[model samples]
Target: MVKIYYYKEDDSPMTAPHDSGEPVAAEELEKLGVFYKYIDSQASVDNLATERQYKNRDYITLDGATFPGGEEALNAKLDVFFNEHIHEDEEIRYIIDGTGYFDVRDNNDRWVRTLVEKYDLLILPAGIYHRFTLTDDKFVKALRLFKDEPKWVALNRIDGNTESNEFRKEYFASLSS
Candidate 1:
């Protein structure tokens, strides 16, 4: 089952609900902006080739079925987009392959790094400064889903305190490990 964290206009900032640990049906996926889908690792590999062919990038081969370039491209195309800053609306995503990291600042002022892999899902509410990075040699893909259709916004260039940014530091530590 897909877990959803619903927030009304008057509700407080929300956190991702716990997963029911059940598989999501395809029919339900159409309604929600985010849902998880699991594909055989081998099938994921084949799909990558197909995607590359469709994009006319034959020279590019996906490593372990991960498509960071594709994800980045799709994200770039979204109406509102930003990196390293807080967003104004809830952002959701479903991991479709490999693994990726989401760095988030919780209400407690503690930074949290969530490691998402195939079939994992994530939801981030507004006003949380976050960033994403893919692990090397990990072929990961995810659907960038959003509640607001026109949610892309470019963040102004600003720096946050690295030490205070717990999520960011934890993610970097994982890379080194």
Candidate 2:
């Protein structure tokens, strides 16, 4: 069950926000310019992982257990990689196991914390401001999708004002309405 919650950047309630796992569908996410799908079962997740093919893209998996320091090392990697940034390539990921939240800004520039769990496949388009964090589970195995050998690069814009954020610019048409 993938759920999304909107919050102001300044609204620091000082608590975790993975509240309700309300049923959210792929079509609903598309309205916010995101593509999402939930696998039928663990069998499907395994098949997808083994086949390593999606639509037309290739996917590669990253496992926390295989890292040098295991969970700690993997958390460090995720922390470094996750940030308020936009990418030139679509950032697609499948949660093979564990859970995390991907906070993506909406048309109003408010953070939408999306809880993605096992068997969840998410496709975030290029040039979207987003970040991620693991839950208390603190461990995740994910398969990353790529059009080519992935050259991961992100333009971090965490310090920008509302007017200057690219999210505000592109979504103005919808926001203005």
Candidate 3:
């Protein structure tokens, strides 16, 4: 079962639990326009993508720089992933295996950490400020789905450039309603 809790602010590593352990209901997440679903892990990826109207898809295995550039590259990637950012399109990720955390900002601008496991599918509305990190195992394999050509861009919240974005404006408006 996927679960969410309030995130604890601390100087611990990104992979640290940093969990307040205070559970948050699924409806609370949905109220922020963050949708979730669960598809059998054995289900066909192509079928799922088609049904969801996803135009492009790929797999990413995050297991300590096991791909290409080695540990240094993996470190760089983690830095990017852990940075609070927003996307121009809905960010969809399906956990194929392992576990990870997706920390999303709530209406009150607090962190809500959700632990995602196998078969879990998260559909984060476009422009939602969020970030991700792996659990202590430091491993997770996920299917990344996109509506069009993959947008691998992340407008980091620290830069203050995401405020005027159209998708972001629309997302915030939906929250008020």
Question: Which window of ten consecutive residues has the lowest lDDT sum in model 3?
Answer: 40-49
List the candidates' TM-scores in order: 0.43, 0.67, 0.93
Worst 10 residues of 1 by lDDT: 6-15
TM-score of 3: 0.93
All models: lDDT? 0.44, 0.66, 0.88
RMSD, model 2, all Cα superposed? 5.4
Best by TM-score: 3
lDDT of 2 by residue, 40-116 (tens): 57576556645645333444434566767886687676776566777766678887777777877776666677888
lDDT of 1 at 96: 64
Angstrom error at residue 39, model 2: 1.5
> Could you give candidate 3's per-residue lDDT for residues 36-97 as a string of tens digits?
87888546656867887999888999987485687667667888999999999989989999
Off by over 4 Å in 2: 8-15, 18-28, 41-75, 159-177
Best candidate (score: lDDT)? 3
Error of 2 at 177 (Å): 12
